[model samples]
Target chain A: MIDIELAFENLPPWAALLTAFCVFMGAFLTLTGSVGLLRLKTFYERVHAPTLGSTLGTGFILVGSMICFSVLRGRLSVHEILIAVFLTITTPVGFMLLVRSALYRDRVEGNDNVPEGNPTPGKQSAPDAAVQQD
Target chain B: MSASFLPADWPFVVLDWSLFIAQLFLGLAMACAAYRLILGPRAQDRVLGLDTFYVNAMLLLLTYGIRVASTIYFEVALIIGLLGFTGTVALSKFLMRGEVIE
Candidate 1:
């Protein structure tokens, strides 16, 4: 087996501590989000769970990665910033589409748990609203 | 090699061990997401679980990149991130409109 300690032997204490703290915190947040996703009672509640990971959990990991590579290369390794930016911008948009889709689906099913709103643009909602949509 | 090291590197052995612990947490997080993906009661729930899975997998790969000190892994993680977003977006659009392109 490869020696983990030896491989990481030269990492500076300060960078090591910083990377470890950020990684641990990110991983902890990710795990918490996963638990929430699994244990939440409703689809809407569960939908809110993974954003914890997709946002700051991912942000922390990317920051830790940027620091690690910069320290390793002794220069700015800002490629991670691309991932962070892309993720930050895209995650919310994807989740919004997903939650809106879920809401539409729930409303179509007439699940009664949905908040008040017309299922379609200008008509009374019904269980068959899905089939009757323009 | 610009790896600045303190005079005593042995005292910080916790670094590698802590990285290993973080990896374990990420793995467990992945398992939880997979559980939801495979067993979710509704279609949207499954899609949400898939969304969680891809994001966690991307971050996990990023941690591995740090562990191995390889920029290639970071590249792969980026690709995963991009693909995950596109895929989740497409899936949600399909769920909403009954077709991705329409």
Candidate 2:
């Protein structure tokens, strides 16, 4: 096994404590989100569960990583910030698409829980036209 | 290498303990996500589970990087995040329109 003590040798006590706290919080949030995903009854409700991990869980972990690297290197290593910004930008878009897609499929199948009407109005015609051509 | 701010004894121990615990939590989270992926009644649930799995895996990598004190892992984590988002988007598109591309 790799020696972990060597890794911590350069980290200050305050920085180490802060990093530990953030990492622990991130891990706890991720676990909770996963459990929520497993336990939620409906697709709509379950869809929200993973956001905890993608957003705040990711945030905490990235912050911890930033701190660890910055302190260890004795200078700001901000590259990890790129991951945080990219994730924050992309996750919501993906979730929106997935949730809308799920809703559309359910609505097309005649599910009553979802609001009536096609979710994508403009694009619906293109698909129908494709079917006609075939 | 930079000098440690703490006197080295207790803080290092605490950091080590926390790292181990964080790994344990992340592992359990991945298990939960996999369970959802396997047991999901619908495709959407499976996709969501897969997404969760991806996020958890990324976080796990971050923690592992911290443990090993390597910057390379950050690049790997970033790539995973990008690719996972694209995959999820494509899958969602397929589910909605019956095709990934028109």
Query: What is the TM-score of each candidate's chain B when compared with the real chain B?
Result: 0.87, 0.91
Colliding residue pairs in candidate 1: none
The residue ranges of model 2 lying beyond 4 angstroms of the native Cα positions read: A1-3, A115-118, A121-134, B1-8
Q: Which segments of candidate 1 are over 4 A away from where they belong?
A: A1-7, A118-134, B1-11
lDDT tens digits by residue: candidate 1, A1-134:
33556556667878888888888889889999999998999987888888899888988888888877788678998998898899889988898888878878876675856755454466544544554463
- Candidate 2 residue pairs in clash (backbone atoms < 3 Å): none
lDDT per prediction? 0.82, 0.87
Q: Lowest lDDT 10-mer window, candidate 1 chain A?
A: A125-134
lDDT of 2 by residue, A1-134 (tens): 44676767878889999999999999999899999998888888888888998889999999999999999899999998899899999999999999888976776565656644455667664434433353
TM-score of each: 0.87, 0.88
